[model samples]
Target: MLSTGGVVVVLAASVVVVGSVDRGATDSGLTGAPSTTATTQTEVRRVDLAQPFAGTAAAGWQDGAAGVVVPVPTPLAGFSAEQVAGALTQVRDVLITARLDPEVLYGHDLDRLAARFSERDRADVHTNKGYRTAIAPGSTLLGVPAKVAGTMTAKAGRPGELLVDTSYAFAYAFRPPDPERVNDPLHIISVVRVRTQYGFYDDRWDATGLTALDWSSYSYSVDCAAAEAGFLAPSLGKGGKPDLDAGDAERDAFDPAAPMATESTC
Candidate 1:
């Protein structure tokens, strides 16, 4: 399920998940067969962004041709959408650096990167096995191309937690010895958590984690077709409004079993 958060396009994933169900009539066998319980899965839609070749032009590319731009979600009471965007950008920077530059990974750079996270997450950043390989050479990782044109609402009551639910495309380039394979552009609607911290020296937000929503649960495709068909658009809320605003009672609910939109083109 999509959780609430500042609209940050970070590389990590995690989030709060809420679920719901609707009861419907079922047929029972005349032979006294057991009746099965039916449950409705939550539907989460991803908004697609237009992708033009990066670096093909002198100045249009941000993260090379695969760089992405995700739309910032509507701001919380005290947080601006731009703030969330900035935080996500920062997180993405670390992720990209972890893969491209080993200096940051081996030196005190990670310490400073860890400083961006909450105390709990800061420790995780230093200890998590995943972070250890984040800067490994010859590793291909997730990339944020550009911000899309939509927003998701942040969950209430959990002031320290930011839930981000949005769809954006991921891109990669193949290296030598491998013939270039042109597959459909991959799109994903992610549910991520960016936790906030209040320390004596600093009070700010950091991407603690990120988790991809299961596309199969909602019957979404793990390819560009789903995005091309425009089925990935953010689900609508009450009164035909995008769920980014309050009163989004009718928006898509959370689904915990949804699988991450992972694909391999090579």
Candidate 2:
């Protein structure tokens, strides 16, 4: 069984076989004969793997990069319309490369994402594992595109600064080593919600603080241990049962509007 937040995904139970025998004696003429019969029963359950997110909250979400929608850019107090548009576009690209890129997610590579930042900021991005998403060594994602939904908005900061805030949810569907053997979607899907703030500055700001990035996130249906190690391990991928007694704090993992979790649920 796999559980995410309050939702539980139960796989097929073990098969059970029952046998029964009957014995009776019959009298014929002067002799008596015994007759015996045996009966057997079995039970089985079926799970459909074709539609992994059919019944989940992510069912109606946008697919892959499409969900990271950037709002229409408008002129801010100190930034022009063009600058706002450019900043919004940059933030969108960063979010995609950091969270949804297959190479980054599976191979743990961050070169491309690091290139987006300045030389001074690149090192911090590389050292910070929280900037990217990764799956365990042997685990892999299902071919299905991830479900995403969120918004990006830009606002004026200080005299020469632009601030962009992004709120989004990414739902990844992972395939078990043996797809045919697993029966629950929670076993195959994990949801990650993120809240991020990015700052873009002009020459007026200090050279060392030209750009900045900060974010917080929470995940559902993911192995707590793996998450702490900076990797995502689906409940089925880890072959572990979910903590049913765990409180409702994790339920917000799927809600983009909810406040970012300040502490680990584990």
Candidate 3:
């Protein structure tokens, strides 16, 4: 139970979950044996995004992710964590049109090509994983190869509502930008994957036919002083809601079930 985003529930079987809690004891607290209370009761109090849940503070959160679409986005149902870091920074800036070579995603040797990724490509790891309190971390972008820093709980539902409990720092840097910075670039926080997802779904599949391929290279150090200061405030405030699993627990961003060969060897 590690909810509040940064999920870590290890069940690995009967999927389907929406998020209120069995992952931690915050906002929605209560586990086993208490489902039979009905004598004029009204205890459904799990809607506290640091209180005032009705709206306003999200300020449409810039709506920068371009109406966020993963499984659905026609009506704008969900997905916070700054719109999944702004649609993964437009999917790492459209991979700069695959111009390749950010030093091949800057060294940290997952053992030389690491059999080319697959257990969901490194079972979701994040180093230099910052974005809401990864505050400065040397202000990112220097030689990418960061690891062992945490914060990544990306749950998905509502045909994938897109959840994102960020804060990373497994950074790297090869810094070879000058090929016109790829003509019209924007590499805020960075990441470049090489190959996986069975090499883009058995070879060539797009339009959501799967193939996120997610290579094991990473980037993204966008910290214009933590975006003008609003790191979501110590994980939300006004008191009474702070234990989003409290710390360091892993997986299950919406029932991961299996994907842990000791944390993705590929």
Candidate 4:
């Protein structure tokens, strides 16, 4: 659980705006998605999070150094568990580096994230828009650790193009770095989209495009339930256990096909 000190708020009710792209653009992760030959065999299934979602607030997370919880990715057929896990790790690394690593935050290290994206997404990240703004100054994430939760689904959208979609809920506190007084904790619920394909040369899956689908519901409340359930930290278990809402409110708001909101505190 994030130790309570003083309230710190950086971004509130911030909406994520995805830049527009030309369908003809070859670089877009969506544009000619990758495809692979289906080995004649049983169909592969979508993978769930590493831990069960019932009762426990935090599932599928391994404790890491400095109070960080590492998320374990579930794998699917056609894609090895390693491939699925690695892709998810890439997304997390990009966000963490862009917000925490001062050098990468402003240098080319950030551009590596666009290696798999389409031309439009690549340009957007470089042009100081959409993905760029999210990682730019005044948006540096607070020291309060982050929680990543989501699933991976792989399918053929086009004739030969394979589209693997990863939906993750990243809960974090947004407190800008400052020498002055402490700020309020601004709870952020971000849903990120990562597009990838099967690499013919490498004979494996590789990330191509990434984007922030939505950012919303900047609550003042902290998510102690997730911290306790995830890492099973003894200290977090104490005090009143506020429910870690399971449903992704911000993600659902953006998905036209998503079902009605099912409230669960996280």
Candidate 5:
């Protein structure tokens, strides 16, 4: 659990976003669908205020290290235990491989880091004029810590949906003359995270063989229930701008079949 003075709120906007590439990212980690591959066993490691990025409240994270498990739910049914295990292992391997790729991404294919997304995932990639874009090659980066400590929580979304939340505390160090100066400030982390909301989603979204109902949720720590509550900050407070920018544009001007837009039916 995040033991900072308290949990503060950080608006979802103004923060760098990534994932699925279709629905974009939500402060609560709910991106239309296809959140990611949720297979790894989650183990939460609460921080001790000594870790980097531990002071902020809205970050819903505190000091210390954490191992985060970003879960991507699948919705298919009828699977032997072996099939489920095999599928998860494959997903894990691919995630690890993503690091080796100069692009720093993960998905079903490896072409131009496009493998970071699946076919069904592409369905939701349709740009509704939401300022969508993919990560440039080598532009993606992460802190694969040797001893990553983290926090996590799960909640209800829109009645039946479940939300798994995780907060990160990252501290990267370099050996050099001015290590102390550059090291401390270089640690960039969100005081809060998107409490990802998912459901018994049994479809193409999941790379793992596990399906809805079969979907198992885990995280770095279960104690995050309170720490990350209400972490999804407000969207852009546009104050009633062109709310129908995409709707108006696509409603008449843009073709629904444009390759840039992705989608699928329930």
Candidate 6:
């Protein structure tokens, strides 16, 4: 359990490896490759907040909720095809509401997101410090849409439960209070990779609704101070670069297929 503002949210300490039944490819259009091709000479261009992803790995990622593509649902051992489909849809809705919604991200409002969880889990959703990426008070996101790319899968859990797993990388472009002062795109952009497992229970389980059973995430190019205080602020706001040493050296924050980081690398 992780404590946030004196509230405890039960989060898995390690990644959950659920055996998945292949239901064909998902609607996600990711090619598992960087959108921009590498060139012999690096091109230098001025950072434009409006076109924040112009020169980054997320340049071709889908905008906002479009990236969360649900896979075709198939019947599991104890679940019907319709049940699987409904679970997938519900999970997708939760992901969009929790991560991509401007109200939750910029306004720090969790009402819509918390409503997606079971009654028992709603409080956790409301109080979990890292559950959502909220911009600091002094800064605001640019009008440009956030870049997203990820995959969703489903599997059977226990006897009458469905487990939907989602993994995604979200890139947000922030406009500093004084945009003219920042010159590098990395300083104004932040990437957050989230991996979550949502459990849907039937009559057998005491709880009969959906709950986020596990959660893990990692953030890049963000201010350590804001992150510590449970807010997302670009590193440029603090007059420094991201603390890369806190994260895995080989991991790329923009890669959806990359493993989910267990802890925040602020």
Q: Alpha carbon lDDT of residue 221, candidate 4?
A: 27
In candidate 4, how many Å is residue 98 off? 6.1
Tell me the spans in candidate 6 whose CA falls farther than 4 Å from its real position.
Answer: 1-45, 204-208, 237-251, 262-266
Of 1 and 5, the candidate ahead on lDDT is: 1
Better of 1 and 2 by TM-score: 2
Badly placed stretches (over 4 Å) of model 3 are 1-139, 142-144, 148-210, 213-241, 249-266
Q: After superposing candidate 2, which stretches have Cα over 4 Å from the reference? A: 1-48, 204-210, 237-251
For each of the candidates, give the backbone clash count: 28, 0, 34, 25, 33, 0
The true-structure Cα RMSD of candidate 2 reads: 17.7
Q: What is the lDDT of residue 31 in candidate 4?
A: 11
Please tell me which predicted candidate would have the highest lDDT against the true structure: 6
The sequence of per-residue lDDT tens digits that candidate 3 reaches over residues 99-179 is 222322232332222222233323221221111122222232433222222223344533443433322222122222222
Candidate RMSDs in order: 16.8, 17.7, 22.1, 18.3, 18.2, 9.3
Q: Mind sharing the TM-score for model 5?
A: 0.29
Answer with 1 or 3, whichever has the higher lDDT: 1
Q: For model 6, which pairs clash?
A: none
| Each prediction's whole-model lDDT (CA) | 0.28, 0.63, 0.24, 0.32, 0.25, 0.65
Residue 157 CA error for candidate 3 (Å)? 22
| Per-residue alpha-carbon lDDT of candidate 5 for residues 1-266, written as tens digits (9 for 90 to 100) | 11112222221111222222212221122123222344353222222224432332213322222234434444324433343344444333332332233232222233533333344333332321011112222222233232223334333333322333333322221121222222211122222112121222224425422111111111111112221331111111111122233233222211112222111000
Q: Write model 6 residue lDDT over 24-74, tens digit each, in one string.
A: 210011123222543453223356766887877888999998998989999
Ranking by TM-score: 6, 2, 4, 1, 5, 3
> Model 4: per-residue lDDT, tens digit, 118-234?
443565455432232133333444443444444444443343333344343434333423312211112222222212122111232343444333221212123333232211111
Q: Deviation in angstroms for 108 in model 5?
A: 17
**Error in Å for residue 142 of model 5:** 11
The residue-by-residue lDDT of candidate 1 on 88-112, one tens digit each, is 5544544444333444433446775
> CA lDDT of 238 in candidate 3?
11
